[model samples]
Target: MTNRLVKHIQNLLPDFTAGEKDLSPFITTRVVKKDEILLRENEPCDALYFVARGCLYLYYEHHAVKQVIHFALENWWITDYKTFAMKGPAVYSIAAMEDSELIVINRQQYEALLNQYPMVALYFNTIHERAYGAALLKQKTYATTTKEDFYKYFKNTYPDILARIPDPIFASYMQVNLEELVQLKQSGVS
Candidate 1:
């Protein structure tokens, strides 16, 4: 698992390594069952999860309804980063969309890791920037587009992930009602 983690990082960062130092000392692996809640609202978010397989979604529950904010698929990272950094309770919950394998690093090791591995620090910075940029772009696009166009954009942007997510969940993420999402999807917009 550690080797796989190293390989994945190297693929993204190109030659990323800890030299003679092993990453296993700073990381652990866990298997999450589908629908398992990894973190819930008001729970302290103490770690980051790197998806080694399967998918996860981050959402907020309002009036008993789940409004998904984001999805993390294979090779992606997921956590309430602000909460993790602040040592505060999560504003949202994260749940497994499928049985998942995750590489986890808790707050303590994460700080030590950045201090110890410059390359790892740079790698995290790069991914964070990209995610932030993409999120801003998506937010702007979603704000300007119609419900249909928004659905199209999501479908076009994440066809693979789109298929992996359940319709109701994806509908919630799109901020469209289930019936409308069904109509849009079946209306030959794919």
Candidate 2:
């Protein structure tokens, strides 16, 4: 496997020890083809994944409609937090938006690493904190921003993701219908 996992960890924890570096070897890697579901709702979420390449969509389905919560692009870590931590069925499913390279760390190994290195826990905490902050921001955007404003913000923040994801999926992510998305696109709203 490539050392992308180690490089990401080292980037996150610059002061890590040699032993900590060794832990990266145990991180598993997998390839997911586009549209493949990496995780399904109601299944156990034993692992979290770091996106080495391509993208994954995190979503919940309601009335057969996908409600996109997040997009995991390269360098992003993704997992069903409640299920992964508390041991239960996942509330969301993760599917590959494009052929993807992923590095995975199962719950057991993650807990073991935290036990051996408190700072590793801190690193993960920071990751969670940022995710939480983004979620809050997303909520605020939905509540306060106009559709045009939201689209502009999304484009500014995730130009790569916008370029790659399909129109319907991108519309779902924005909580808008396909027609609305097309109208917005046609309007050339920045």
Candidate 3:
């Protein structure tokens, strides 16, 4: 598990090295079953999880309907950043979409590492920038792309996501209804 975590970090930052010792104490591994909620809406989110295996969905409730905001697959990260950073209640719920394994690090430990290690901070900053860029791209795609074009873009961006997650969840992430998603798929738009 430690080796895998190290490898994961290495993939993100090729120059990073904790020398096995520093990295050992920073990680905690857990297994979660399918449909299990890792973090619930309105709960405190004290930790961020790294997916070593399997998939997780981040969702929120609106008008009694759950909407998926993001899906994290293998080698991805999941967290409710507002709750974790501001000490507020979470607006999102993160659930396991499949039997999964994760490595979790609490906010305190993460901040401590950022303060103590420049490389760790640099790596996290890169991660944040990438996430922000992706969000911006999604917003741009939503605003300028036609619905069919949006579906095609999503398919091109995340080819395996449709097979890995349920249609309702995928539709929610795309901000479309299931029927619309079906029609798009049928028309080979996605």
* Leading candidate by TM-score: 1
Give the TM-score of each candidate. Answer: 0.95, 0.93, 0.92
The 10-residue segment of model 3 with minimum total lDDT is: 18-27
The residue pairs in collision within model 1 are none
Which number leads on lDDT?
1
Can you write out model 2's per-residue Cα lDDT over 81-146, one digit (the tens) per residue? 889989899999999999999888898878876777677787788789989999999999977999
| Model 3 per-residue lDDT tens digits across residues 1-190 | 5577678778888988775578656667899999999999999888988888899999999998888878788877889977888988898999999999998988877877677667887777777788878878988998998989988887888788768888888889888899998899999674
Task: Report the error of model 2 at residue 3, Å.
Answer: 2.3
Q: So what's the TM-score on candidate 3?
A: 0.92
